[model samples]
Target chain A: MSTNATTEIVPGWETVIGLEVHAELATATKLFSGAPNRFGGEPNTNIDPVSLGLPGSLPVLNEKAVELAIRVGLALHCRVQRSVFSRKNYFYPDMPKDFQISQYDLPINGEGWLELADGRRVGIERAHLEEDTGKSTHVGGGGRIHEADYSLVDYNRAGVPLIEIVGAPDLRSPEDARAYVSELRSILVAIGASDGKMEEGSMRVDCNVSVRALGETELGTRCEIKNINSLRSLGRAIVYEARRQVDLVTSGGRVEQQTRHWDEAEGSTHKLRSKEEAYDYRYFPEPDLVPVEPSDEWIESIRAALPMLPRERRRRLADEAKIETAAAALTVERGMDDLAVEAIGLGADPVRVLVHLENNLADGIGSLSAGPFAALIAMEVDGNLTSTQTKTVLAVLVADGGNPAEVATELGFEAMEAEELEVIVDSLIAEHPQDWLAFTSGDDKERKKKAGFFVGQIMKVTGGQADGRAVNELLARRADA
Target chain B: MTEYTARQRISRSEVAHVADLARLSLTDQELDAFTNQLAAVLDHAADLEALDLTDVEPMIHPLPVHNVLRPDVVGETSDRNEVLSCAPSIENEQFRVPPVLGESP
Candidate 1:
């Protein structure tokens, strides 16, 4: 919302933000273990020897997880290469293996670009395959969470296939970060790689935020905000954190490199740790698992099978409609772009069709075929039905497939004849000559107000079935006379 | 013994830090003994490092295989009750451990 946030917050200060998104690949089994990779189950019910980190249990890579990761790589325009898995050593209660298998130096997907909804391309550094950790529930100590006596953990999610997407620090505003995640989520879902559900923790985000004076070449030290789950939270947290950094710098304090946690309820960020105490995740390649070298033929097959991504789909729809891509974004997001495009192809007014889609049909695109949808638009376009009547007919048509005309007639939504509307408008003008004078001679704002008054009077007489556009045309003719 | 004494490859403090990361409690005597013992292992590795093999490609594993993947099918899982019975602690059919308060939430 703050396009000029730089001026608003200490004139020269500019905020820099980068995002790291972790999405769970929709696979049947764990990344390296045979345990079920599911969202929720009875605790420990989905565990295997590998998931539980039992002795003598070795991990074997899941082919489907690899394929899904590859799908993500190709969708992001990355080079899918042979990747090695490294053991990130750390001690955590939820990590039964005392280490997480992740991609360290060599990632499967490297150097890609994700285009924002506004056609701004953000550079993607890498998207590597990894395993998710188990869920932990802190028990006891009620209000004082740090004082909790113990923690309970469920291993159901352990070893679930995950693709950690690392985005370059290209985002400046918080809004762009939200757009990046939303755009990325749609791509993930459209390609059938991830469900992209942040609420369920299937998709997670961490942002690295820093601020420096505008046009300053050197980058500021960034603090990593971890586990931001929702798009709204991502924006709000960035705004708060950026201001926090700006204030700290202005107060003769240095911004230390650290990991911070966003407190949604407090609308502030709290320090989780400083760089000094950061885990030296003694990273070494996992000896148990072999390198994942995907063949070129297999990569081509995945690339061939990808459906049209959301970006190209939005671009195509916007080009066909001859409108801004942002205007067609919602229609595409709701999976109605094809329907809107097809209706447009059938000579339906693109603007009106898009407007109808934006106003109505939000719940669903309805089972009504493109032909009927086009016919309905045509009826409205020809002034045979008011947009309101068109909506009434559309509801029935969407609920039940039938002729648009028949549906209109069945609903008693017959568009008023032009002569009938003309007669009503003439009489109303004669009755209210003073208002008509204001409408004709008044300023632009006054005319719009008086026009609304006439439209209201006309709709009252016609039982809301008159075409507003037709009534306007009749009013204009009468005013000229 | 002579080979290990040829050079003190690993320091005692480094060994102590590694032991600390593993959460292993060791006395000063154990640290001194392990430092020399572990230095011998590093000495052998230093010999390999000394070899001129710049042309040889770096290999992470000796397996003649690259991709050893299994089908992503939900197969056998450990019995919850049986697994819980062997655990150090269990609460609400889940693994129970002392509350971890550190780098991550």
Candidate 2:
């Protein structure tokens, strides 16, 4: 099996992939209780009777969870419909209620489409709401769940609201699967519904991979791969699973439908269990809760509150602002897209604003507001200070939080007098007589190359405080003299 | 009055699987007895099939209410010690249970 090559290793076998993403909604309280919906607290401290499944306790649906779900649905272009809650009956120790309250037939968001960055559209089957289970820690026997002597259940995470987004089996490769997850994660974070942290298990993915003969429209038996924590692992698992299935079917063996677990340390998937005994979850409507039918006014309000999503923002930056693809992606991922847009809206140069925001500085642009940032760009553009000095001023504004001009003066970025810069440029031109002669007599190509050398000399003597454009003008005048 | 029209019998293995999922340790004799009793319950409920329920949607919950919700405000979290008092076993303030075979898929 080739790890690097997902391009037809077995010759005539195509892989079909789809993903199921489970994202925890960013709500203050638990889905059905007043327990604080938080992460990494003392075990079981963020629990209430409703979350613990105590007898005679009824669940009160969290209105904010529903609103966030609607926002996510609209972001995914899904139909926000009248949905109902169902009790998924099972006897898991992690589930204190002995059943999970989830949506069965009618999910809140239905029939949506997610367009990848490359323009491949993956249909969203449904995004349904459910309550999360408690976290279980396996104790003893190397802490592996299969061999542990005992398990401890922390109900703090129980009853956290989750929206499971199921994608249509339209993905054809491992890269496509990764792209789908990345795109979905950005949208989740953009809408402020989830933190979209795969490492923290705030967002999780279950990948279903299958392989079929080339040009075969009918699908093959798919083995679901779970326990994948990172996007890199998702790509690796899909490649490995597809090859495993293709080799099995092509070599006189049949693919068995089962669930596998991806071991990140081993870089391989192990068979968790065979899906021979089909689980009849015995799903029925939850008796303790009623249906959710959002009024048009409520739905419209949620729709109206949606911020500009990642895709639209990226498109605007690329098409209108002429920002590069990588820079636009970085700005959006860091939540600096709006700041750049605001700076540009204040008549700042789009190119300069994008460069500063995408510079990966020590302090984020969020530390300084739009007005201060625009002023810094304006100063740099007007030749009051060099680009380096402008960055220093921006840093002080971010770290110490003050007016940009005062910080610039305090940091000695107040513009050098014209004669002072002239003296520096004159000395550099005289010292580099050979390069100056070559630049004056050389063709446009050589002149353009040596122009940078003269500018470098002047900036080096002035500790990068002299503006490069001003030094260039001075050097051009000296050549004419 | 309702009359039975259709009642499908359940297999013994099916009964055992259901018991396993429910975490009930049932013996062969208990399984045999409960299989018969459960089939009787199903037969009794099959009387509904005799009436034309095709036009009527299946009632999920017998309630006229919909959209029962509460505001997203922090009320009161139960005391950890008080909540753990009801558990049969506790370790580090968490409920301890026998090691699970594995997580369900």
Q: Pick the lDDT winner.
A: 1
**Candidate 2 local lDDT, A1-481, one digit each (tens):** 1122255545788888889999999999999988999999999999988898988999999999999999999999999999999989888888988899999999999989887664457899999999999999999999777899999999999999999999988887777788789999999998899999999999999999888888787999999999999999999999889888988887899999988888888888888877775466889888788889999999999999998887777776666467555457767667777778888888788988888887735257647888888888898998987777887788877776677888888877868789998887777778888998899999999999899888777777877878888778877887898
lDDT tens string, model 1, B3-98?
345458888889989999888999998888888889878878888999999999988677968999999888999999999999899999998888
| Cα lDDT listed for each candidate | 0.88, 0.85
Across residues A1-481, which tens digit of lDDT does each residue of candidate 1 receive?
2233543334678888889999999998999877888887888999999998888999999999999999999999998998899999989977898999999999999999998777888989999999999988888887334778888889999899999999998888887888899999999999999999999999999999999988786889999997587999999899888899999998999899989988787888888889997888889989998888999999999999999999999999999899998888899989999998899999999998888888898988676788999999999889898877888888887887889999888888777887888888889989999999999999999999999999999989988888888888888887888
The interface root-mean-square deviation of each model, in the order shown, is 1.6, 1.5
Report RMSD (Å) for each prediction in the order shown.
3.7, 4.6
TM-score of the A chain in candidate 1?
A: 0.89
Report the first chain's TM-score for all candidates: 0.89, 0.84
Superposed by TM-score, candidate 1 places the C-alpha of residue A240 at a distance from the truth, in angstroms, of 2.0
Scored against the true structure, residue B2 in model 2 reaches a CA lDDT of 31
